[model samples]
Target: MTGWLDRAAENAHKFAQRNPRAVAAGVMFSLAGFAATAFGVASPSAPGTEIAQQIISEDVQPLPVHEQLEALAAHQLELNRSTAGRANDTADRLLSRLGVNDASAASFLRRERGVRDLLDGRVPRLFTARADESGRLKELVVRMPAERRDQITTHFTRVTLHPAGHGGWKVRREQAQLESQVRLGSGTVRNSLFTATDEAGLPDTIATQLSEMFSEEVDFHREIKKGDTFSVAYETLTADGEPITWNEGAGHLLAAEYINRGRVYQGMWVRDAMGRGAYVGMDGQPKQRSFLASPMEFSRVTSGFAMRMHPILQTMRAHQGVDYGAPVGTPVRTVGSGVVDFAGWRNGFGNVVEIQHDGDRSTLYAHLSRIDVRKGEHVEQGTRIGAVGATGWATGPHLHFEFRIRGVHQDPLQVAKATQTPMASVSRAELQQLATSARTQIAAARSMGAVRAE
Candidate 1:
């Protein structure tokens, strides 16, 4: 008998090796029969088991890949039902621990219904529950929806639990703290202040602030010259030893200084009386002048004050002033503090304004389209007196700027020279000390390659 059983076992093993699929089917059928028999259900051979046999028998067909995927998906859905219910229960428990009542908890769950949409698609789903060292549920994360990554990330709102001493959790919005630093360098310009500031790594917002600071002295669009240069000290946003710049919105104007030509133009960021940001001079005065030095930012001098034949009139005219060829309505300014002595139309000089200064000095602006200041009105240095226009015996819109000494007309361009205010004797010592410190700082910055000369 033992020998016969061994031969049967060998034949079965060989059959399995030859037809693995049929063997697997037979094993499945045997498992089904055993399960029925073990459960004490009626067997196929037992009397009065016809009803059970009919119930168990069915016509089965092989399913395609798509159908098989659908079946697996349905089974996964059944499993996820329990998971989803558990998640909802967990969310409820979390909310309850956070002091939310039943009504509020329901509303909160409704608000988070979007989390359910994650399971409806054919994508893979992963659920992870995080716990503290004490095995308390600290967090639950359900990663899904590649497109909603950012949105889901934002939903990771934190709920702080009261110290373990307390019985429940206290929920609150989470916030992150940020800190930054900046180091601004300086540069010079041979053209416009706007262009130069851009080249110096300063943003438009900072450059605009700098322009506003010196608007009274420098006409950004008109008065800048080729030999004019500037120096600035400022700061930039930094993090982890790297500088940062924003493409939109004003970043920051830490601090800045500018020196145009030989004039020391300085400005620092400050809060105004109304608590608004602004740039003001070191002396707390506005850096702006009333008017600009020239009608054009950079233009060549075509005519000077001398005897010359009038181009259109065909007569030798004693040209008492210099001609600045600029566009129409180019502004004319008083070179120094003075009072308007005359502002009206003249026979040879079009619409003109004459400003009488101290020390028997005066200035005349002729061939103007409009006069801004009235006679007897006090005008400061660089104050706009009129607009350039061909209102008199002139050929084009150009400012006829004249300088006079005791009523004798002289060349305006040559008479005016760059002058520095004399420092008081007491202030001179302080200035020298400041200059020494500045030199040292500037030298160090240069050695470290923090500054570049023009």
Candidate 2:
């Protein structure tokens, strides 16, 4: 038997050597079959414990069809739409555009005095309306400029009309605190500052602030070159995150850079621990001089301190003050901090205000429609002392501003450049940090503007 087994093994080895590929394939197939039987398949369970089973039956009632339908209706779809209130936007018309078909909502809007005023102005207003999927009005809200002119910068008017809990619609009108949103913008002047700002999609208020921020170093009206550029980091006032259209949503100018006639000027707003803040330059000098450059925030220079044809006299005469053409109700501010020396009318300068400042200097604002200060009252720089009007011996509504030294008339434009020391309390580290951030922000704004231009 041993001899026979050895002969068979010798014969198998010879065959394997001749067909090595066939032998390897056969070995792999046998290993895979063994693995599949051992691990890949589950073992069967023993059938020793068999238990008896029983079946039971019952009937269950479902909810009523109406109740199921009511549950679905409770989650009715709500729709929202927004539109601007035009001068010709009636209650029905506005509601129609907002996808509302309810006549009761329109009637309620027409009946309420506060709500009706939303469509009274020619200036378009942003309106948001909520309704059901069936076009029934749910609520209407509109954010508008403040009613009082003085609060335009800090306040906004919010009007809401909705269904009252009792049943009929109720209108709510209130003055809301305007929240400030930080904004960055940049523009290059091709024609004018206003034009550039418009093209750059910047607010008009920012343009005015930029002009005022660099007024001491550059004359925006006369010295502005074609290629002048500006960058600004500022704030825009919003009510409930919605920007108010009127008054340009004006807020504080935080930082600014102006390139006027090839000279680069930069300013950053800085504050101390006392909450007092001011615009300062890169060298930490206050941009505010001894006085502000203009009484109004922004306006066209209709007349300068030169010999010009008098509108009333029809003869060429020396225009002692600058005339800023603006609407009648435009705010007129004090150019410097001072005590009111005169707050009554003069012969030609009707309803005038004269402030006596330090350093033997004084300033006068003429042709004011209303004066907010008395003769003995002390006023600060940039205080609204009055509003512009055509009450004087003049042709139209404008501000006649004059700067005087020792009772002699001087150029109003020159007063803003007068040397004044900066505040001493601001920390050096705080200002440096603020300047670094402002520098980066201005650069970013410029780059963004360039990208948009391209």
Best by lDDT: 2
Candidate 1 lDDT, 163-239, residue by residue in tens: 22233333333422111222233445756665666665555655655565565566665666765554433333221
Off by over 4 Å in 1: 1-299, 418-454
Those runs of model 2 whose alpha carbons end farther than 4 Å from true positions after fitting are 1-78, 122-124, 147-149, 165-167, 271-277, 290-364, 367-425, 452-454
User: Which residue pairs of candidate 2 clash?
Assistant: none
Q: Count the clashes in each prediction.
A: 11, 0
TM-score of 1: 0.29
Give the winner by TM-score: 2
Q: Residue-wise lDDT of candidate 2 within 1-454, one digit each (tens)?
A: 1232233345455435754543544421111000010000001121211110000000001123224335645655347777777877888888898889887888877886656778885654788888987788788888787776446666778888888754488778899877654556666788878777776666655665566567668766677899888877666666765656766665556678888877889997654433344668977778756577678898888887876788888998888988899999899999888899999889899999999875456898899999999998999888999999988697889999998765767767644532333357655655565677677656656554454444
| Model 2, residue 114: C-alpha shift (Å) | 4.4
lDDT of all the models against the reference?
0.47, 0.67
How far out, in Å, is residue 342 in model 1?
0.6
Locate the minimum summed-lDDT window of 10 residues in model 1.
31-40
